[model samples]
Target: MTSDADPRFLRSREAILNAARELLLESGPTAVTHVQVAERAGVGRATVYRHWPQAEPLLVEAMATVPMPFLDKPTVPTREWLRRELTAIARQLDLDDVRAVSTTLANTALWDEDMDARRAQFAGILTTRLAAALDDAQARGEITLALASQDAAAMTIGPMYYRSTIERAPADPALIDAAVNALGTWAAG
Candidate 1:
């Protein structure tokens, strides 16, 4: 067994992960088997299986490497922030790769405990960012949320996911505008 501190081990791991990610983007999650990843990584099948015993966790980890749209920019007014957040979500969901990976994550997570935990962790990060924005707005006295920021985030984000992934339709400008307007009304009320 190679030590984790070994440079070769790290390089091999990185290569395997990158290969898995490429497979996911090129052919979707169904293509990300141990043999396929090993072949793509130029490593042995044992190496891939040794590192990730299950295909689901490996796929989830690869998807985690994806760069998600974030609310990391400078803070803006609440309304502006909400609009920008929704717009970002719509744009990300519009991507074929993101949609495919997202659907895979949602589906595999149902049967894999590790994947489910990873999925929850990913979702928590997004929800926390959104909640922070809502909390900031409340602090500024811009809007009063009738529900918690987490709940507000669900209201704002759930529809975009549904429209893009479930409906297999673009998250149109009208939908974004309506989500923004509806959230504003709910918060104001």
Candidate 2:
């Protein structure tokens, strides 16, 4: 049995995830069977199964590798910070392959509780970060609305997600800018 401490074992596990991601994108989640991933990765079925007992978790791990924008430690207020954060998110979401993978995971996660939790956890991370930015913005008088920080964060992010998942459209920079500007306008009211 390959232990977690084994470097070769770690490489095999990464290979499995990479293969699974590529297959998931090419053929969707239903086609990402252990044997298929193993063959694509040039590893054994046992190795793939040993690392990821279930396909959902395997895909969740693969989706986790999708790059999110890196936010700097906020020394500034929320509205300004949120603008920067959203700009970064917009750029990341503009990548066609990244958008496809995200949409696939979102579709799969709806029916799978494990995948749902993974998606929720990922969203929570961004929410918390955005909330902090919002709070700082409020303190600096950058926002005058009485909305909760979390709600404000959601308002800023929800549209992008809606367009990407529901509309199945690429995130347009102009649209993102308009959304961010609209949020700023609402908060200033």
Candidate 3:
């Protein structure tokens, strides 16, 4: 009978993922080699490779484990929920691990078929969530004017990305509030 305490059970896929996440946070994607991950995880290089043959997929999986922000549709109204949700997203964007993942995605030179597919999947997740939030807000009469959910989402998230990547500045609560207010004004106009 196989014991649950076997070494295989001890070093599960999650252990590998955690080790990879740490490496990505510390040294970026380029440093996430199989040997390096094995050293960090205290596992053999062969074991790491056996679990994840390529580095990009492994990194992508590690990144996916990082929680993406989502706004819960509230029975009250969309505007209130959006304000809360955008604030949360802004706060999450300030996290070092989140910034590291964004930086890694921007710098990855592997633009092959697999990477393209993965990028599309990642984008879809963001797009869908943003759309839902905007729709909920519209339904609640929070946004008075006609604006596409996609555009609103872009406007809301773009500044956060700019501050995180281009400016290399931490996201401030005041800044997020300002963005939300601006969006609300535009909608009301």
Candidate 4:
């Protein structure tokens, strides 16, 4: 259905969305009004409001653009792979865009049904990737065959989220190592 929209119309809409995302990352939701988006997008306010009657939908869409990569297999030892993945997460969290977008998403209460669904969808994609990484580790004799892929995926993300959000601590690589080791998070199944 969306694909049936006019090419020019769709392009304009994308410009508005991109503008909104930039504003959000630069100054939070309050600063990203439709008028501001229109100005940044080089379009009219009516166009922005026509597409997004409210800013919440725009905010959610903008947030969907935030980049989040999943695990890349390390040479051997699953711990090493976990180390690299977690370290990369920590590094990404350091970016302003990541912080702005993630802060909005991490505060669960702020999510509407659409935002929640989008967030879940992205999480599912990441989990699938995590599953692949876990499968690889298991194949390489680093992870145990008995471990559930979904559980392993959760194990990989949950702590990093906790450290970055509630704990108000950096998701340092060393901290990741310690936390996983302490939990025995992925211990032989």
State which candidate has the highest lDDT.
1
TM-scores across all candidates?
Answer: 0.69, 0.61, 0.63, 0.62
C-alpha lDDT (0 to 100) for residue 82 of candidate 3: 65
lDDT score, residue 58, model 3?
A: 81
Model 1 agreement with the true structure over 119-177: per-residue lDDT tens digits: 89788888888788778877777776667778766787889999999898888878877
lDDT of 2 by residue, 1-189 (tens): 668989999899889989988887677556677889999999989888889776656766765665434444765545455567776766656655446556756777889787777778788777787677666666667765556667755676777767766776766767766766665443443
Better of 2 and 4 by TM-score: 4
Instruction: Evaluate model 1: give its lDDT.
Output: 0.78
lDDT of 3: 0.68
lDDT at 183, model 2: 51
Ranking by TM-score: 1, 3, 4, 2
- List candidate 4 stretches off by more than 4 Å: 1-12, 18-40, 44-60, 63-68, 72-78, 95-97, 106-111, 145-147, 179-189
lDDT for position 138 in model 2? 62
RMSD of 3: 7.2
Per-residue C-alpha lDDT of model 4 across residues 1-189, encoded as one tens digit per residue: 245378978998999989988887787556677889999999999889888886656776886786544564345566666677777777666654455556665454255676677778777777777777667766666656455776765676677776766676677666777645642345553
TM-score of decoy 3: 0.63
Candidates 1 and 2, the one with greater lDDT = 1
Residue 10, model 2: lDDT of: 86
Model 1 bad stretches (over 4 Å): 1-11, 18-59, 63-68, 185-189
Please give the distance, in angstroms, between residue 26's alpha carbon in candidate 1 and its true position after superposition.
16
- The 0-to-1 C-alpha lDDT of every candidate, in the order given, reads 0.78, 0.69, 0.68, 0.69
Query: Which lDDT tens digits does candidate 3 get at residues 1-189?
Result: 436577775566667888988887777556667888888888878778777786766877766666443553444455556667777767666766566656656556256565566666666677677677666666666664355666666677778888987898876777776666655543442
- Of the candidates numbered 2 and 3, which has the greater TM-score value? 3
